[model samples]
Target: MEAFADWLASSELGQYLLCREQAFFDRAVADAFGFRAVQLGLTEYDFLACNRIPWHGYAGPEASADVVCDAAFLPFDSRSLDLLVLPHALDFTSQPHQVLREAERVLMPEGRLVLTGFNPLSLWGSCRLLRGRRDAPWGGNFFAPTRIRDWMTLLQLEPTATAFMAYSPPFSRGDWLSRWQFMDNLGERGWSLLAGVYGIEAVKRQRGMRLIMPAWKPVKAGSGLAVAGGNERHPVKQSVQDEISHG
Candidate 1:
């Protein structure tokens, strides 16, 4: 966990999300929705979640809001959010299913959820094994889009688009310059099949749980006013009505 956090903190990708200029997900999402706020995984995110650049100015420098809690159990009213951005959360999370379900619950119907993660079958995943490390987090369960689509299906989220990126990790060490150049020049164009990561965009599904208040329901008076015939009055439920009316 520590090694992964260190790499994540120092990596170019981290800088992009934190600073907004380098992170592809941040830039793409900001462009797509122009959201007024976003929910970040601060509780389980360790360092990356805590130190985030607010996309909107409404949450002032110390505002600290838009709901901060566990990703697996998000503290949000269902179907009230405009967008949910999952930044490589599945790579490390133990309860990915629960986390995804919570994300699906919060997102508004037709809202977009943008997810990013490393690719398992890419060159990057292979490189991790060559270093004599059997259990590193670099490619920890890096899933292909098809596998992810299965997970998304369980949550009822529909995939809208998918994109691959980071054909080459930005050359860092002086020694890796040759490999980077070779990969960029020849590998990417011809045989560089391993992309660093993949991103996915999915639309939130509208479950049948939407609550509908009937037009004829009597409005209770203010200040704890008791209804005279509350027990006798039955509101018409849309779901039941739809089922009965359809037949």
Candidate 2:
């Protein structure tokens, strides 16, 4: 994680990816309404900066985090958080599935969950395969967006929106990256699923009972009345009938 952070802070390609991801997060989290929000990883960056939640904080293994804890076992109570952001936390975590389950447990029903991850079906994935498992980001697990959606569906986290970014190939040189900028637009317009990174916004859904009103039978006018001396004299029933007539 530290090596990946260092690369993000230093390498041109890493910086480019970071910038694009930040922009994605900014737009994704901006309209999410909530009382409490938390970012699970990438403690160095403020992924929730654009969020209007009353309380937002960072949680990670790093000392700089407001709540230092493992992503797989978050310390928050069940259904406590209104929003959660995972910025490549799943890729680096050893227990990515557990992390996602923990995310589901902590989020309230209808709470928003936003996550960014590397796509394993893209050019970037091909590069990582070529580079082997010794590099910083290449060593991390890259899950496909479809697989992630399937996982989220199992957890009842219905995907609401998604965006793909960083369509350019992973090039360390600034000039090379600039030359490939045209691919970004092309990929967004025609080949979005093959983008290097993907951001997903999902909402927690829980089964709820639909309210059903009890059926009431209407009283007939002469049913509960007694014919006493040719006069139907039931004061209470008469009052009820009067009320119903008026109504």
Candidate 3:
């Protein structure tokens, strides 16, 4: 995982994919308003930079993370965060389904979840097959978009938006990548599923009746209801601090 992080920060191909993913995240997170937002991994880059959420932070098993912890066992309370971003975190982790389960556990009802993953049905997947599982990304598990959506469905996360990007074939050299840049526009129009990466935005849903509370009634803290207003210290933050201190 550390090798993959270094590759994303330094390699030419990594930089290209990062630029494309950044653009997608910038648009995906712009409209997701909330009190607390947490990005699960890729701590080196700020994927939540475009979010309007007042209190946002990173949590992962990295020294640079605001709260160092495993993605599959997040310290946050159930239904605590309003928005969560996972940038290629699932692809790298061995417990991808458990990580998704953890993601569902931490998000509040109606909270938004955004994730990006490499598509196995794309040109990039073909390149990975040719590489014989030799490196950081190629060796990582590549899941199809439909499979990810199916997993999200079982977790009651309704898909709101989905997009495919990085249509160009995987090339190590910058000049080769630039020459194939036109494929991006063409791929979006003709063969979207064959794109290198896919991004998904989903909202958590709750079953049963939702009663409207009277304005005069006192609202309890950590009630698992969405709160909007000035930034305040949330219970999730406290849990994060405790986890860090105890560790």
- Candidate 3 regions exceeding 4 Å error are 210-247
Which prediction has more favorable TM-score, 1 or 3? 3
lDDT of each: 0.58, 0.91, 0.89
Stretches off by above 4 angstroms in model 2 are 212-247
The alpha-carbon lDDT assigned to residue 85 of candidate 2 equals 98
lDDT accuracy of residue 137 in candidate 3 = 84
Relative to the true structure, candidate 3 reaches a TM of 0.83
Model 1: CA > 4 A from native: 1-5, 11-23, 34-36, 42-68, 132-136, 169-193, 207-247
Q: Candidates 1 and 3: which is better by lDDT?
A: 3
Check candidate 1 and list the clashing pairs: 16-23, 123-194, 187-192
Worst 10 residues of 2 by lDDT: 227-236
Per-model clash counts, in order, read 3, 0, 0
Model 1 per-residue lDDT tens digits across residues 49-78: 322334421110112434545567766688
lDDT, candidate 2, 37-154, per-residue tens: 9998889989999999999889998778999999999999999999999988889989989999999999999999999999989999999999997988898899998899999999
What lDDT score goes with residue 19 in model 1? Answer: 34
Best by lDDT: 2
Ranking by TM-score: 2, 3, 1
